[model samples]
Target: MANGGILFLWCSSRLVRTPSFLLIMSLALADLLMMLKLPIFLIGIWCQGPCLGLFGCEMYGVVSVISGMAAIWSLTAIVVERAWVISFSKLGVISKLKWYTAIEVVLLIWISAIVVSVLPLAGWNRYVYEGYLVSCSIDMYSNNFIDKSYVWLLVFVGWVGPNILIFYCSYAIVRANRRNNTLMMELMAVGGDTAQNFQKQRILEERRLWRVSSMMLTVWMGSWTPYTVVVLFNATGYIHLINPHIGMLPAVFCKTSAAVNPFIYGFCLPKIKGEALKLLKRYRSTRPSPENSSRFPNSSPARTPRPSIIHMISINNRHASTSC
Candidate 1:
């Protein structure tokens, strides 16, 4: 349900023709992929441990790796986009290409993820049941050099690299917003003209972007950091405690991140929420009042009282429209 809600909002927001909306859509797509792949992992767990051993774990491993990589890459792309916007005060070179580079980037990420994931099928790596816990992952400690290389690649590209990029981008945005705010306040204090007001508005927009980017960064780091740290520990042979039950904890946390992203991207945006509420109220107001419906004796259920909430909503909408 979280995935569906986010996907709906992303698609709806895309009609607004804003860079932020486009970035939200990109994040939404990544969340959707994560949500879609979750059931497979759950099913594997339900079957009493990574189910790949019973039913060709190789295929599951490939798909999981691909989806996971794509999700990470999407996060990286968002960070890059935010950096470009903050640094250049425009959509950057890719955005100016008029070729829907965001969509292309998403597609390329998926392709690369798939290619990297399926390397095992070509004997570059191997997939094993890993002691029957219905979950599948790369066997990093295996004797195969290819398997070890694949694990390192995933760690570098999907985990460490993205986190570094995201952190840098978030810091840059925060610093830029602070600088812009200071400049705007100084200009205002100096008896600035109307042009300064426009500049102030632009700085405000930048601040808003920084807030959203920071929210995403916080969520990403909080959700995935534990899992990455644990994996690193295991890979280095410092912590030999590899339990399937412990694995599920990280997966659950990661999946919950997807569930919350829609709220972050959609309901958090004041304009989008207001527009949605307006549409909902308009739809409700078209229904008949309870008394009027009863008097008709043959009214359908759809013609019942729209509820007192509708009136309250209508008033709110009127106030908002007037205020605007």
Candidate 2:
């Protein structure tokens, strides 16, 4: 909820949404949708039945597949965009996505997810209670040939394909960064203030690339990869060796990506951090301190207090000031 609130502020205050930022927003939105299903799941657990019985299970399964698929696809798109920029555009370049282009990619991603999600309902396979009957998913453990085929199709089209694309992009970006480092070294051999400045900028780029790569790899492995392994195990009858409850660990682990992602990318962004600080300051300003209220219980609500923060600026030959 805090992440959602900060996003609301970010959208309101942002003048231009670059393609990267737009992709990030899509990621957050998809993850948010996935997390929203948790309460429904909890309710179902509390009652000791599917949220709407079998039908509710179907609904939950569909929602989970769609949202989870969309989140991964969005991350894939983000990686692709980053690679595109690093490969072709100048360092630190910013470009806004064309509205139509953004719309098309987002539609393609979600539509593909929806198409796969609904197949079970259409009888290509079916949703069934799984994970000790607490949740529903595609009947991966079914012996039917049709169900087996669907699982294979889902693994290839939904999971393997995206993983390949993401890894390829990451590799390309790393190669591009290497080239950039060599160029930076040649340009900075002079050893002066200018060299120091260029060296700093290059280091920042390297750090940003490292963050993006590490976050992407960690999230993919820590969340989705385990679930993918679980699904493969179930499909192959390999899950029989493990305790049923233990096999469900991956499903729960994947769900956590929804929570971990926002902190990794959202809070890490400079703009989001700025907005968060603003929110904190705004909240503090509206609520009174316990010490002040106790010492002067009848004090004026609108009373002016000494500034806790001040800003100084140069306006040409004149100076300007502001305080908070």
Top candidate on lDDT is: 2
Please give the CA lDDT of all the candidate structures.
0.68, 0.77
Provide TM-scores for the models: 0.72, 0.81
Whole-model lDDT for model 1 versus the true structure? 0.68
Worst ten in a row by lDDT for model 2 = 311-320
lDDT of 1 by residue, 61-126 (tens): 665676567667776776677677766673233434233776677668778887888787777767
Which ranges in model 1 have alpha carbons more than 4 Å from their true place? 9-14, 17-23, 40-56, 90-97, 129-132, 141-143, 190-214, 270-275, 282-297, 300-324
Which candidate should be chosen as best, given TM-score against the real structure?
2
Measured with C-alpha atoms, the lDDT of residue 195 in candidate 1 is 64
Name model 2 segments beyond 4 Å from true. Answer: 44-51, 91-96, 191-208, 286-291, 299-324
Candidate 2 per-residue lDDT over residues 170-205, each given as its tens digit: 989988897878787897799988888888888888
- The C-alpha local distance difference test score for the whole of candidate 2 amounts to 0.77
